[model samples]
Structure formats: structure tokens, C-alpha cells
Target: MRLLAFALLSLWACGCAPALSTFQPAHVADKGHVQAELGLDVSVPTGAIASVVDAGVVLANIAESRELTEGERLTLFEAGGALALNPPSVTPHIGVGYTALDRWELNLRYTGSALRLGTRYQLLKRAKHGVDLTAGAGVGRYVIDLPVGSILGLVELEDFTRWQIDLPIQIGTAGTWYRVWGGPRLMFTTFDTALVVDLPAFTGYPGERELASFSGTGLYVGGQAGVALGYKHVFLGFELTLAEIFSSGELAVLGERAVAVDLDSFIIYPSIGLMLEF
Candidate 1:
């Protein structure tokens, strides 16, 4: 009976998003056991999509300071390499855990857009080279709907929905293969959106029609660390998370009056997993 293979990196973030799930916070999966996992989640955006790729490298330095034509300077260096080489957003993760009584544990996760269910409580329990603690709470739903020329077709990101709440705390140590953890996570998010902007004849105005609406609230403060190894059933885990994304908003249009937005950002999440326990 040496199977507390801690691996609960089920972290999350919203406001440029995702925890990508790679959690380890003290053990669970003993009483009536059941654990399953699969993962790969990565999100790296150093704030506002890296300032929109540094404003596309400052519009390729303003198309090399005025005087265009060369197909508009190759469409401004291909829209500044599509916003400065945008990359680092990968998702795919799955999780399942159940403990039922005796320390309680229940979790379900997914990371395509978002889907989560959580429960954990094992508040310190590990002796013999001890250290264990766990805490949890979760709720999620994040979706971004964009269609109708989303960028080349001409700007659209109509309707975005986000509703999340998570509070996690974990501290760890485990053996019989190996496991280590770290924690501190808190996320509370809310969102609403609508946008359809068109105007890009090299900003020569007159491409009218601009509608905007945004409603937001976000707070994410994070910390996570992880490690895991395998043996009696298969395990492998790795996690790292760092966060800061404070947001506030109210921006309206379509007959104006409603403005206030203060968006702050920072994020770096990484996860990797492979687990099975029965």
C-alpha cells in the first residue's frame, strides 16, 4: 500500500489563458482508487500577446518610414509576420481522479478550450519523511468564437465567453517512485465580448463599420512547480506555472458611452503528463 503517486498539476489561468493542467498537491487516489491522465499543455504569452507582437515590430518600422508601394512594403512585412511570429499555444490534456471519502478527491479536466471539475482535500497527511497538503476548488468554461474573416477576411472575434474560478494550494512530497510538488493558485475570471472591426487599407480610413463591446474581470495569481516519476502503474509529470494577469473592463460601442479598461498581463504555463493508476 504505497501508492500516493502525487501528480495533480491541474492549474489554470484566464485572460490570455489556461493552466494546461499539471498538478501535484499532496496525494489522493487511495480509497476506491482511480486515476488517469494524459497531457500536453503549453501557453506562453508575455502579456497582451507580447504586445501584439510588439505592434508587429512597430509596423515594420512604419514600413521603413513612409513612402510606400512594393505592394505596400509587402503588406507591411506580411502583417509583421502575422503579429511577430505568434506561437506557443498548444493544448491537449485529460484527467480523471476519484477517491470518495477518506481524504476526499474528485477531479475531471480537459483543455481544448476549457472544461474543468474539481475537488481535493487532504490537508496534511504524510509521515515518515513527511510533508503533504492539498486544497482545491474549480469551475470553468472558456470559449472564443471567431469566424467571418477573422483577420485576413477582416477582423472578427465576435463573442467570447469566459467564466472561471479556481483556488488551489498544494505542498508535497511522496515516495515509492518519486513525486514533488509546489503550489499557490487563484483565478477568478469573467468575460463577454463582441467585435467586428474592418479598416485596413493601410489605415486610409473610410472602411467604416466598427462595432465593439467588451465586459471583463480577471484576477490570476499563480505559482506551481512539479515533478514525478513512475513505477507501480505508470507515471510521468512535469509542471511549471507563473502568472499575473489582472484585468478590468467595460468598453462599449454601437452608440458609445462605456469605457474603462485596464489590462495587465503575464503568463507562462507548461505541463506534461502521463499517468495511470487503478
Candidate 2:
């Protein structure tokens, strides 16, 4: 995915000069000017931890010894340990955003899906360089899982999703070429799960939907860098971001268990977008 993102961005960013320059058709470029920011932010994290999963797919594709065709039968167990290391999961995402900068220069941003909504206010803003602070919170569902074995019973894993809250604080520089930011966010959960052996049966466990569960929360810090170009009413930009998602939860299953499973992750995503400002 990182390879694909890099490739795609290179094409767009390289071809964007004229497009960026033409995006401010009505802007008179003066005091009390009002503008709106409408863009899509997509993040994809590909650090060492993520590579572990990606390499598994590459090796498996090679070992399969056959040309992999779309719609063809492909089984993880058949592919070997490589497939085992990777989980059947879709990346978490948020989209649909709108922002407005009033004549007084106050900025407001709203970004998220229907399941959750995140709103941020720029406590400070400056076109050249200045601090822009944001605070946001929302509710969502997640879970903690333990290893499965002959005993936690049928190891028939299930019941591991819970309601939760996400509170993130962000501080960045407001700029046209780029903006750099770093801050910590707090995560809190309504329930908790803990210690035991992670047996071979659950070595590649992503999560057992059937196992009733809860995950403890932790604090996280991350940063984002963004660049934009505009010509007339058309504008283009991209952002690279990374966040340390921390959550440590332990669990005992069947007759086995595991402790302090790294429920934390680092992710990156690059996105392209178009916006019209008034």
C-alpha cells in the first residue's frame, strides 16, 4: 500500500503546479478575506511493524508457485506462516471534512465518518507561521482478544467489541507549503482485559469476534506534514502522518494466555484532494 501511495502521489504532485496556481479565482488577497478548506486526508503507516505483515504477503505470493489471479482460490493456511502473520483486516479510516476560516481568522474543521465525528478549532493561526491548536473527541467500538486453545473452552472465540471514546489534541503550524504538528491524545475504555499464555493456536490472532472482551486505553502522540498548491479555484495537496496507537491488554483463553500484547500501532496515509475557496 505504501508503494502504491508513493507512486500515485509522485504522479499527482509532479503534475500539480498549474493546477495549484489556478485554485483561487475569487480571492482578492487582502485583510478580512474569508476562505474554506475542503480536502480528504488518507493515512497509511508502513513502519517496521507494518513491513512484517507486508513481507508475509510478498513471500507467500512467490511461494504459491502459481500466477495469482483475481477471484482465484487463495487460502492462508495453504500459503504457510507468511499468510499467518498478516491479519484479515481493513484499515481504519475517517473521511468527509470541511473547514472554514472566518474574516476574524478563526478556523474550524470537521472530519470523520458517521460513526464518529471529530471537530478541531485553531486556537491560533498565521499564514506565514504560527501555532494552531485543536481538540477533538468521538465514540467508536473496538476490542481486546486472547489466544485460543482447547480449554478457554471451545476456543470458539467471540464477543470482543466495546464502546469507547477518542480524544486527540493537535498543535501545528499554519502554512501554504507545509505544516508540521505533534501532540498527544488520550484513549479511555469502559472495560479491561488481562494476563496469560498465547498458545500456538492463536499465534496469528488478530481478534476472535466471538470472545467477549475489553481493551485498556493508553496515551498516543503523532504528527502530520502537509503541502498545498493552488491556481484559480483548483487546489491540490498531500499529507503524511504517523501516530503511536497504544493499548496494552492481556488475556487467557481455553487453557492458554498472553500478556501485554502490543495493542499499539504506528500508521501513515497520504491523500490527494481538490477544494474550491470563496
Candidate 3:
């Protein structure tokens, strides 16, 4: 039962973890110009307390059938990398971008746990000391997994997936040596999660069984800001983003009432990267 609680908490953490997106500049690259970047990201949760409370409730309900003592319930909640308020995690990312015809750009990025593809079209060129405009769209997919040991009797948490899409309008300026950009992004995401538990015949529950599963989708509006400095073919950049999510979803155990888990409404991301342009 303790192992089961730990597995549940791990799944919840993975589902709520943040994935960073690449910053898009308003100006497209020159034809045949290619850019590659490597970066690290940190997500600061502004509403982490709410997320923790939600997870705690879900875990408590799961243990209700086992008649856990209050102390055991507390311990269960704290085990297996339990959700923490304001605890931040770091992830590394890599991306490659290309420009075609000096007017169109495409970028593909991976952030360890997520994959993103984006495209942009230059709508208007920048005048001297003025801003340029670009419109673009992005799609991303993410997967999260948590595997408990076979010694624990075949408890596996896998196949937690999320898909996201966004449309952004960028307004910014680019000069020979520097660039600054900001944009408003409209986005949506959907999730599918599963938890599988298999105990040995000696443990009473002998067969494999799914403990919990859920699906949900959310819509969000966000803003991003970025700045970069270029010297020759090498550039360095930093990006910051904040978003609010309006989400609706319910988690369903095989034989229990569906539990509603409202996702965190506020999210923040900060990242820095080194880029090479050729």
C-alpha cells in the first residue's frame, strides 16, 4: 500500500511538470541560415500550494480503503518525490531552426521529456529602429514515466502523455548586433494518464490491474519576452514566460467517483541558451 501511494504521487508530479518552449524572433533568418541552440530551463510555480492540496486529496482517497492511520497517510503523502510547493526542477533542451527564402522559418526542439515543432511567417519587415511583425504556430507532445522496482511486485506507472498547441503573434526589433521580442500566445493542451499495479500471488491481489486513469484539456493565454545578443555567428539569448490556464478534468478510478483535479492556473518559465548560426 505504501508503494502504491508512492507510485500515485510520482505520476501526479510528472503530469504537472512544466515543459519549456523555444523563443521565436520576429525576423526570419536569411535563406539557408541555420541556427542550433542548447539551453537549460527552470519553472517557478506561483500556485503550487493549490496543486499540492489537490494531490493530497487524491492520495488520501486512494488510501481510504486501506484504513491508513493519520500518520501513515502523512508519510504516504510525503514519499516518492511528493509534490512540493515552490520546488523547482531543471531540464535541458536543444533545438534547430532553419529559414527558407528569407521569409519562412521552421524550428524543431526537444526538452528531454517533450518535443515541439513550430513555424513562422514574416508579415512585415522592420524599419530602422522599428518593430517587425510575425505570426506563427507550434505543436508539442510530452511523455512522463515512473517505474517502481520489480522487487515491489510489478508496479509500473507509464504512458502519461500531454499534447499542446499554440498560436503566437510576435512584435519585436532586430539589429545587426542585438534583438528583442515579445508576444502574446494562445494555447491549449490535453492529457492522458494511466497507472498499472501488479502484486504477486502471495500478496492477495495477484493479477495486473489499472488503479487510476484520467483525461483532460485546458486553454491558456500567455506572454513571452526574449532578448539576444549576436557577435558574428554566435549568439546568446534568454527568455521568460508566464501563463494562466483554465482547465477542466476528472480522474476516474476503476470503482470510485471521478475526482476533479483543477490544474495549476499560473506558470512561469525562465531559460538561457547558447546558439550557433551558420
Provide the overall lDDT of each model, using Cα atoms, as 2-decimal numbers: 0.61, 0.35, 0.61
Summarize candidate 1's per-residue lDDT along 167-226 as a digit string, tens digits: 888888777787788887688877765655444444443334456666667787878788
Candidate 3 residues 1-278, lDDT tens each?
54454345434443244454456566777788976888876655546434454454555455534444444333322221112221234557888889976778888887756778888888888874366988988898774442222111223345666788878788898767777888885888787655444422333333334455556777767888899898756778898878776666655556464456555557677878886777
TM-score of each prediction: 0.33, 0.44, 0.72
User: Candidate 2 lDDT, tens digit per residue, 1-278?
Assistant: 76773444333222111011111111121344444455544433344334443443453344334433321211211111111111221222323333434322223333321133344444544543445655555554432231231111111223333344655555554334343444553544433432221222233443222222224444335554455565644456554545554545443333244233343456444444554334
Instruction: Name the lDDT value of residue 97 in candidate 3.
Output: 82
lDDT (Cα) of model 2: 0.35
Superior by lDDT: candidate 2 or candidate 3: 3
Question: Which model scores highest in TM-score?
Answer: 3
Per-residue error (Å), model 1, residue 57: 7.8
Worst 10 residues of 3 by lDDT: 78-87
lDDT value, residue 228 of candidate 2:
52
RMSD each, Å: 15.4, 12.0, 6.5
